[model samples]
Target: MQIAYLMNTYPVTSATFIRREIAALEAQGVSVRRFAVRPWDQQLVDDADRQEQTRTTYLLAPGGLRLVLLTMAESLRNPRGFWRAAKTAWTLYRNAGRGALVRHVAYLMEAVHLKRLANGCTHVHAHFSTNTAAVALLCARLGGPGYSFTAHGPDEFLDPGAASLGLKLQMARFAVAITEFARVQLALAGGMGIWPKLHVVRCGVDVTDLRPAPPPATDAPFVCVGRLCVQKAQEHIVAALADLHQTHPQARVILIGDGDTRPAITAAIARHGLGEHVELRGWADNAAVKDALSGARALLLPSFAEGLPIVIMEAHALGRPVISTYIAGIPELVDQQTGWLVPAGDVPALAAAMRACMDTPPEELASMGAMARARVEAAHDVTRNATDLKALFSRYV
Candidate 1:
């Protein structure tokens, strides 16, 4: 089957799962074409191009210098793609004569982005609920194959109207949400009868290849992985590290991933005198991060909001229990068996949970870790997820 994968920003350094999922599908002999918005800004263009399988295309819209604007004039304003193009034109016209209007012209570029992906694909699946899905849905409406998308996390789930849910549902044949919570909320936000079409498809991880934790010779190391942003609640993790240090001074804390809040998080570490105990290792790739998770005593993610974060699934697959917040769909994975879930923004509670993990014996922690692996294998296998996608795509066929 021919498939087109759409994302708001492809080659995003932060979200390697996009590439992982595309690789998983192509491995099954499916013809997968990749498309992205704002392509030039991405640094991994070389990585996608070097791939022997799947064809990768960049949707450079109407703004650049010459070609895109002319293409927009022909294809975007074309009858099949008129409504979206008109909306784009209107947005541009509204801001006309101002230099700022030029950027809004990017919307017109969606006409070309969609048209190119629709050419031979049997299905179009976009990631997240930003304008990326808008472009995919717009193309599907203009005689493209059935289109769908996977929505994730805060920006998309927290603010529904930003993605134009009415238009999204009207154009989408199916909608996938990373968490059950996200699925229900998107249904409510869409304000359409298509609520029944929403599906909960948690992003999966490779269960077999994950490395096992070290033998019980060394003291357990606690780690947290994700961008150091507000939603990640790294600050809470820092507070927990302080508590861990006061009691179990032998416990070591390592942080992976980088973002806007690095300075503040680093400053917090200094304020708490956690320099000796805590270390920041920024932006490790999937394999490296998984290796870290494999050896860690626990994977900490005290986030303020989430949509079944892929990291949590990966951690469980690697045999590590997660210590996370109860917000959104987090409770689905973390519960009495696998890990602890505390209220969002509760630093003291998070601190206590960390101490509990540190104080727990190695044999007990290992049993919980084994449960993590079992839970992931039973529910979130990558192949199973792809199989379901094939069945879902058959509807459009």
Candidate 2:
């Protein structure tokens, strides 16, 4: 099957394991084409360059003031129609807007983009269930075969009046939710009655290739992997550092990934005088992250929401335990058995969990980590997960 892949981001270094998934699909005999939005990120350029394959790229014709205005007005409405109208308007916006003169201009440009794309893709699938999906839906309607998208957190779930619901239900052939929790949230919030259309395909890891966690060490407390975003709750993890230090003074947090919140997360760590104990190593590439995972005691992901986070699965795959918040599809992955689940945004509880984790015996943690690996092998492997997704795509075919 030929698939046209779409995404708001091709790669941001910290995200876009999506590239690897696409590569895997291609290796499995799927003819794949890519469509992405800009401003183009370097990480994407690197991956695309490394593959040495050229893809037809399209960018919105910049300077569409009228388009922005129309989308803004449409998005400000009530909880229900906001996303729908806004999405419809934004498609017009992306191509340039719905104004009388611009409509034909935008339509002509869209047609050109498609002609350049040279349609043979069976399904057009966007990574996130938002703007890119809207773009893909328009492409499908403009004579691409069918469309689908993978829905994950933050903006898609948090935006109340987002124009994603109906677009997801009626436009796309079938949508994939990273977790069942994400699917439920889409139904409850997106006003998509046809929630059954969602296929819960996890963001998976390279199952057999996962490097096992390093043998228990005396110094490292926990490893946190994620961008320094408020959604990640890095401050909450930093807040718990002091409480953790009183007992496991030798323990330190090795933070991976960086973003706008780095300064705030750093300041919080310092305010508590735990700077010596927290190491913000900025962004590490996937290989380096795996090395850290191999060496760390446990993985900590206290994010406020998610759609089956890949970090948790990586931790489990490598036989390293996880400490995460209970929200969205997180609970579906984490539990009393795999790892500890802390309350979302709770500083004290998070702090206590850290202390307890540090104090837990190495042997016990290893045992827990083993259980974590078992969970991934049983439920989150990408091969099995891909088959399920292919089945969903076939229904639309």
Candidate 3:
């Protein structure tokens, strides 16, 4: 069967899990077409993602006039579909706040463009229940392929009204939640009717691609991988490191991602006199990330919110235990056995965890690392989860 995968921006540094999902499906004989609303203009560190950008069709790349002309031709060719899409757009404009009218109109135009391009596809699956899902809903209304979407938390659940997540869930043929925690949130927002359409499909990593590296022989710097954003709380990590330095002066942390919060992170490093202990490596590709994980004492992520971060799984797959906050779907993957779990925003507790990682015996840390790898093998195997996702798509198609 043929399928179209829709994304807001293709090959984003943090959302590589989506790329893995698409590759796994294609490996199993699924004919998949990749579509992005816009091209990612940021510096791409991964060669694989750079290659994927060439294969994806960007809907907004043809300029405004071309989009208007193509949309007009599509409307003239299929008047009934045009009316259906128009009615849907009108409903969204009326029900969604007045400020969203222009955005909804843009979604309608993009839907028309997608309907023209997505020929011979049996289904369309989008990654987020935000803008991409809104466009997918309109695409279905415009006589395009049946559409579904996956909802990852922190944003959609925090502000469902602004996101119009409930309406998107009702419109989709099926909906995917990355964890049971996310599924429950979708049910709460969309009501009991959404339960039937919701499925739990985790964002996973390929274990075969990850070779287990020996644990660090001595105390090594901890590594954190994710966007340098407020939600990730990298600043908190910097603060906690200051407290940790009083006891374990040798403790160091290397943050391996980039975002708007870099200035604040840099300030924290300078403010706390952690310049020597903290290092910002900007963005690294999957290969570089693996190399970073292989030599680390542990992986640290003091996030205030998450949808079960793929970096946690990647760290586990490489036999590196994780130290993350107990928020969102994080508890489902991390525990005392796997690593340390601290409450979010508690600097004292975060510092204590960092100190524990430094003080723990090498043999005990290695044992925990082994358990971490075993857990990932059992729950986050990309090949197995991709088969389950394909089966779900088959049932709908």
Candidates in order have lDDT scores of 0.72, 0.70, 0.90
Candidate 1 overall Cα lDDT vs. reference? Answer: 0.72
lDDT of 2 by residue, 1-397 (tens): 8777766655456554676677667666677776666544444324443452245354453345644543444334332444433345454454432353454344333433542364676777888866676666655544456788888875677653445455455777777878777777667754656667777787777787895665668776589998789888888887777777777777788898878899898888879888788899887767778888888888888888666778888888998888888887787777877678888888788878777777788888888888888888878777777767667766886
Instruction: Indicate whether candidate 2 or candidate 3 has the larger TM-score.
Output: 3
List the candidate numbers ranked by lDDT, top first.
3, 1, 2
- lDDT by residue (tens digit), candidate 1, 1-397: 8888877666665676677677777777777788777553533323443352134566664346554755446564566555645564554345333564454456455645566546877888888876677667556544556688888867776555544665576668888887788887787887648777888777777666664565333576778888789989897788887876788788887899888899999999999988887889986666677678877888889988777777888888776878998888888778858888889988889888888887777787778878888878877777777767667777755
Q: Estimate each model's TM-score.
A: 0.89, 0.84, 0.98
Stretches > 4 Å off in candidate 1: 40-55, 61-63, 72-77, 83-104, 141-143, 211-218
Q: Give the top-scoring candidate (lDDT).
A: 3
Q: How do these models rank on TM-score, best leading?
A: 3, 1, 2
Candidate 3 colliding pairs, count: 0
State candidate 1's TM-score.
0.89
